[model samples]
Every structure is written in C-alpha cells, then in structure tokens.
Target: MLSAVAGAVRFVMVAIMTVVTFITPFLGKKEGKIERKAEECKAAFAAISDTHLTDSFIRLGMFEFGLQDMAEATDRLDALVINGDITDHGYPEHWQAFTDTLLKYDISDNNIMVLGNHDTWGGDRTGDYTKENFIKYSKEATGREIDNVYFTAEINGYPVIVLGSQSDHTGPTFYQDQLDWFAEEMEKASEKGLPIFVFCHQPFNGTHGLPYNWEMEKDADPTEGGIGEHSDYILNICNQYKNVIFISGHVHAGLSNTEDGTNYSSVEKVGNVTSVNLPSYEYFDVLRHGHMVNGTGFVFEVYDGEILLRARNFATGTWLENYDVTIEIEK
Candidate 1:
C-alpha cells in the first residue's frame, strides 16, 4: 500500500509540473512571431555609412553584402538609405560603377538617398555638383530626380528628410537656417497629422575630433560650429522640433550600449545630437578612419504611432540592438 501511494504521488506531481510549464509562458505579455517579424520587415535596411573611399569593385567586397546577402535583404527590406559618400570626388566613372550596383538593387521610391561631401567633388557653394546634377545622376540610376540640397520624404510611411553633405567640414553650415524651411514642410505635414524623419550627413551640433577643426595652433579651442565638433547647439534646435526622427552620417560616429558582455556603438551620436550614423561603403579608407571599425547602419521599424529602432550587423546577419524609441512632433 505504501509503495502504491508513493507512485501515485509522483505521478500527480509530474502532471502538475507539466501543466505549470505549459501555461507559464502565457502568463506574461509576449510579442508574437508575426508581430516581431512585422517590426523587422517593416523598415529593415542594410545601411552602410561614411564609405569615404575611391571606387573599386574589389574594395567594395566589404560592403557587408555580396550577391547572396544583397539578394536576401533586398527581398525583405522596405528600402535603403545611402547616408552619403556616393563617390570619392565626383568621379563620374566611379559614381557610375557605384550606381551600376545600385541600379541592380530592388529599391523603390521608399529608398531615400542623402549626398555626402565625397559625392559633391566640389562643395555646395561652388555649384560644381548642384542639386540638378546630383538628381540627374540619381535619376539615371534609380529613375528618381532629387531636387534641393535638403528635402524630406516618407519611408514605409515614416518621416525622412535628405540633407546634403556639407561642402566644407571646416565650419558649421548654419543648419539652423534650414529649420525654417524644414518647419514649413513640417507644418504642411503636421496639418495632415503625419510623423517626420530627418537624415543628414553631418551632425547638427558637432563637438568631436572628426568634425572638429583643431586650432592649427596647439591647445586652441575648436571653432564653435557643426554639432560633431561642438555641443548642444544642434541638439537644442532639434529638441525644439516636434515629430522628428534625426538620422545622420559623417564623423564616423556611433551610439553604444552593452549587451551579452560586449560594448558596442548601436546608435550614432554626432556630438550628442542623437541620430543614426550609417557606415562607410569604402572597401578601404586611407584617411582618418574609424576610432572603431565594423561600422553599420540603422534599421528603423515604423509602426502606427510608434517606431522601433534596431542596429543590424550585416556581417553577422543579426541585430546587435533593439530599442523602443519615440520621435514625434509636439501638437
């Protein structure tokens, strides 16, 4: 009788344990696979930033994507955001080669392109590479004509504005000047009640090494200008705006967080004015290169009212980051 009772107790205990285990997962809120994938595919992008290199097919091998990876991401991504550096000095042939590859891409109107200093062979003031010229080449490659050195667009129904890469990294461009124009556009969109996304090559309030101009003399203070070389000016201006998501390139800058026992820059900060800094497309950079290598781009998942930010490593085919971020215009 004792043996039989022990066996019955063990059976009952095992049944209780199995029941608890099966139902425990449902006790708390969990994101379903469909919802998770919806976030991933919503704005999945393979953004390569900085890429200040001359042109070469072999050098581009490090583009984070060869033929296979390119084809895969192409199928799922909403678009690609080439933050800047389309070419190494407005070399027509070089740009042609890069565009040739881009032409083969399965991008759509949703894909937004921003010009970098390397793209302009000459600065914006010189008119060497005017909006017309840049848009002309862009049209030839993607059949879309980009107008204005600074303009805004929508991606997967998210706000994204394309600002030209500065002609001279020497001084600040008074990017604030563009705010009036930017505000005008935002007002129109605001009337309609839509979100806004902003992207540029340089940081707004630069105060760092790459974007900062040293005194040419020793221990001299950096000329107050761009965000990367300065501090708070740009961030303050941006903070004043509403429904704005800022994304930037240049400075080889990044935002970092610790995960699984590793320290990494998952977000790009241009002198503390937070934004996404895309990595370089250059196969090799002979000049002031990464204080940190393995640069990547941001994948912004924009759902209704809420946007999820993710930093994806193209090399590993995994997301190194995931964050719930908010960027909305004030009513």
Candidate 2:
C-alpha cells in the first residue's frame, strides 16, 4: 500500500509540473528578482522570434511596447532582426498583416528577417507554400529583394549571416547546396578574422533549452525538431570555425525558469560556438516550468570583450529583470 501511495504521489507531481509548464505564461506575474537597468548602450541590436502574426488586431497590439522601447532606447537602431515566423500562416493576407503592422512602427530598412517554417509552409501543417511565395511577400513587405534565403548582412561593420532552408517547409532541411553555401560564407567571414553572427529559424541538433533536444535521439524523426539528417554536417561546419555565435528559434520555450534540471537558460556555449535560443514572441507552451509571455526578446549589446543579452517584454515595456545574461567574446 505504501509503495502504491508513493507511486501515486509521483504521478501527481508530474501532472502538476506539466500543467505549470504550459500555463505559467498566462499566470501574468511579474519577475521581480532581477535587476533592471535603465541605461542604453551603443552598437546594440534587438532580436525577436516567433511573431506568428495573424489577422487579429488584438494579437498585433503586442508589438507596440517592444517597438516603443526600441525607439526610446536607440535613435539609430543598428538593426532589428526578426528571427522567424513573421506570419502565422503562409498566406498572402497573413504576411500582409505582419507587413502592415511593422510598417506602423516604421521597423526600418535595417530590419533583417530569417524565414521560419510557418512562414514558408502553411500553418495547417500542409506543405502548400513555396520559397518563391515567401520571397515575393517578403520583398513586397520590406521593399528589398532577397536573392537567397541564406545570406549575410553587415551591421555596425560586423558581418551577420541569416540562414534559412531552401525548401519551403516547416522543418529544418539543410541541403548539400545550402551547406556548401554556408561553408563558403563562413570561409569568407573567417578570412576577415571576424566572429560570425548567424541566425536561423531552427535550432541546431542537441542544443539544450530548445524543444529539439528532447527528440534528437538515435532514431527520432528529423521533422520533429533539431537539424535532423545533416546534424553532424552542420555542427562540423560550426565547430570548424573559431568564433560562431549561432542564434535560433522555433521551440517557443519560456525564458523565466533556469533552475530546474530540464529547464535551461536561453544561452548555451559549446566549443567555439555559442548558441542562443530566443523564446517565442507568441503564446506557446514552454519547457520545464513557466510559459513565455508575448513580446519576449533580447536587446543584444556587443562590447569589445563581452555581449550582454537584456531580456524584456516589449508588450509590457519591462525588462525580464533577472534574466540579463553576459557572454564573453574572445578577442
């Protein structure tokens, strides 16, 4: 009877943790423990992920606070990089909705976007859209022609590479062509003796804190998460480089909890590469504990020796307070 009772208690705890993980974002409680800095720095850029813009004006309002904060923080914003998922669905109308809203805030020509799976593939989990369509709507919205899905842009004299899958689907597919292109870009950046800043919609395989890490086992399906088939090839390229800061999103993981064993901080440094996973800017269930609230992203301030990632909720115009993290840049 005692053994059975203990087992039942264990089951109940697991159930509670699961519920908390999903529902914590809706809890609406402020994170009070972390310190908030009012000062703004130079040579900083803001990055966000998983906008998942739909036709709802109510959902669109979430961007107001973040935009306002950026305007107030910096007059000449170096670049505002939207990691991916600009549209909830791969519909022209949905993409237009995102473009319309961003225009209201005047999200500048410096805005850099990396295509998310949902942006290329329809939200119905159907592979209905094409890469051409994504580029079309993107060009129409940004007024800039995207020659390739994966390309590099210079921000503050630093080379930042934006990577996306060539195929239009809601999964990470690194074709040999794309891999070759990446290697070529990395070589060029390496020749300049500059640290490469790479942004992709999907996180690399085996990255902790990302949702992909859970299913990256020996036989797990590739579409579920992570790089999947060419995981080794991708990582090999990253490892070959001396300084590669790879940023990604797609997990929609929350940023509040970093204590529990399974709950990891958004930042993880492996070898020469440091991977930072941005939490969802939309409503999605998170890992371990706490769901992420809307308008959650970091204002990355890169200094000579260190980079500070300041977490904030643009919706609320408040800093995550406790989640400000610092990473060293090898000089």
Cα RMSD (Å) per model? 17.2, 6.3
Q: List, residue by residue over 1-331, the lDDT tens digit for candidate 1.
A: 9999999987876565344333332333322111233633445444556554345543344442422243455355566677776566666676666666666756444555667765676434344354555776776765655666677666665556666643444333435556567656655655545455667665454333332322323354444324344234446545555556566555444333333222333343443234654444332211222322233455565655455675544433445434223432244
Please give the distance, in angstroms, between residue 266's alpha carbon in candidate 2 and its true position after superposition.
0.7
How close is every model to the real structure, measured as TM-score?
0.67, 0.80
Per-residue lDDT tens digits of candidate 2, residues 217-284? 54655445665567667778888886678888887775644653445667787667888888787654
The C-alpha stretches of model 2 lying farther than 4 A from their native spots are 1-42, 123-129, 210-223, 260-262, 284-287
lDDT of 2 at 76: 47
What lDDT is obtained when candidate 2 is compared to the true structure? 0.69
Model 1 spans > 4 angstroms off = 1-36, 39-46, 64-70, 122-125, 130-132, 165-179, 207-237, 258-274, 281-291, 322-331
Q: Give the candidate number with the greatest lDDT.
A: 2
